[model samples]
Target: MSFIRIGFPSLQQFCVNALVAVSLLVGGVAHAEGGPATAQDGERVIKLAAAADKDPLAVMSSAEGRWFQKWADDVSDYQFGPDKGVFWFHNGVAKGDLMRVLRFHHTVTTAAFQWQKKIKDPRLNPADDDAKTLAGVEGLLRAYEVLVAKNPENRVAKIDDLIAIRNKGGLADFVKAMPPMPSR
Candidate 1:
């Protein structure tokens, strides 16, 4: 019997590391209730989040916005094929960023459950070694839920927090940290 050794790092580990880095960068008490400025920043935050949420291929195809589009394409490249495992890992990081945006949206503006539901997509459900990674995403969701429930004004803060995090460190480090695939 031939054993297939998958030397790659599990998605959960990648999520943990990515989340830890995010937490370190955006230090603050996970407040249940956000401050009042959440509403004012809601629109700006949403636009940024929406931009980030664009389809990777569409972003890559944009001729006029090549620089920004390339960034999205690079992210998509990590999520498919032999790189799938790495995709799951960075999914955790993306989830963390998305959670921050969602919290900002819910807290500062009207309560909208759409973003929350999207994050809970069954596709993200963890399995086997993926359980821990899924849990990390869940943790981010829980934080957003609490923020929304408490402040309903954290929308802007969350957006600002996410932007800062992304600028400080793009997703590249997380992508590089993933375990490499075995040579055929």
Candidate 2:
């Protein structure tokens, strides 16, 4: 007797659909395993981010950034399957520094706007105030130079790691730091 072969498109579709459903179920369960971040933890993360942004030079000079970079690189090597998650965590952390930079820019802009408003005020000297603002901006730029000199790849690397952390739990920490929303 000759061997018989069977090819069924409907059967293949059923198998595919079953696999998709099972995968989604398992993924949802795995994601639900991690608990939410506490408010204290969130605040700590926010503070770390703010501090890094405020004085990147200081952070680069300290042992912390060096240690963290090494740790992150080490993690990158061993955890091949979770690479995306780790990178996301790093990116989230890096965004904190960027947020600080944006805040600094806003501060300077606000100061300039105030100076302009008081330009003609008898008590306020717009020129002197403007000079101080420019000085502050120059100082920040210098700090950035120092930071980059110490860790040339820091900003990008940190960002990648933070993104991974966010995907895992770092983003939750940020949200917890935010004031609670009022009930509708």
Candidate 3:
């Protein structure tokens, strides 16, 4: 869909498309089956979110000013869903199943990134700014925890790294990268 296109070439076109796209995207809501978490979906959600960030207008986080709260809600929805054991690509998924994960995660991460940007906009920011960003980072950490549990291998997503990028504190505070993983 045109709404899925991130980094549109022109700003004017982007703004117009974003306005129309947001409504269309949210118009439909697929009820969650509350099935078990799958490793494949976990990995896919983070990946899609990252890709969507390239163009802010493509998702709710960028277009919707109050996106962080919505993202917090999303985290809860997935976090508390019926505890089905995890699965990676090893199992299977329906067509476009991954797309839903992508849409959801991308919107969430984009919202967090935007908030991180807002509070840290100025180099000499206030302590409150760091606090706000950290709060957002914490939510992401929890979300990632559940995702990583699905398959630690997917930890390569280095989600903590994204949060660290926003923190930009000394390396001491930067989230560590995943340790070397063994080949399957």
Candidate 4:
């Protein structure tokens, strides 16, 4: 599956921008007049987003959440269809599961971080590793989504297993081993 990606200097920058935009959009700070929004506004939003342990969209207004969902769909191949409810994470995995996964852990974050650090190097292809990692991340999300729907009773344990697989850098392997998720 093709993964949607945000064009930013780094995943960190993307998160900062997302938080800032969410804050402005939700707070009614970003108006046609340009308003009084300042760098500090973005900073406050960044702090809030950083500290959040659940999906970043959780705290946003419905409008803001819809905006974010569209943005994620446009940028990354991950689609949060309108019919599906919010709240992406399951029992055991919290803090940086989807986009956040690209930031923390021994997940693709490590590779993406390294790539971002060396972004200036001409030899490095920005899309190479990050794209694959993103696809893996999307796979992980899809797996969780299906497991929770199909086997609600074992969601906690399934999430634990997925987290373990992710931590061990086996996202693709784990996804490949799973039964196919039903098409939306």
Candidate number of the best TM-score: 4
Compare candidates 1 and 4 on TM-score and give the better one: 4
The TM-score-based order of candidates, best leading, equals 4, 3, 2, 1
Off by over 4 Å in 4: 1-57, 60-62, 70-155, 181-184
Winner by lDDT between candidate 3 and candidate 1: 3
For candidate 3, lDDT tens digit of each residue in 81-168?
1001111211232113233333344335533443434422312443433343343334344444444444353353344455465567
Clash counts for the predictions, in order: 8, 24, 4, 6
User: In candidate 4, how many Å is residue 90 off?
Assistant: 10
Candidate ranking (lDDT, best to worst): 4, 3, 2, 1
Question: Which tens-of-lDDT digit does each residue in 1-184 have in candidate 2?
Answer: 3211112235654564445434423333221112342333223323333344444433433343343233223422111111122222333543455434423432332222323343222114535444333333333333344344445643455434434655575554542343322334
Give the per-residue lDDT digits (tens) of candidate 4, residues 40-129.
Answer: 333333333332223322323234434333333342212222110112232224433333332221222222222334322212453533
TM-score of 4: 0.31
| Candidate 2 lDDT score at position 31 | 14
After TM-score superposition, the amount by which residue 37's alpha carbon in candidate 1 deviates from its true location, in angstroms, is: 42
Position 76, candidate 2: lDDT: 20
Worst 10 residues of 4 by lDDT: 77-86
Cα TM-score per model = 0.19, 0.24, 0.26, 0.31
What pairs collide in candidate 1?
Answer: 32-150, 33-150, 33-151, 34-151, 38-108, 104-155, 107-152, 107-153
Query: What is candidate 3's TM-score against the reference?
Result: 0.26
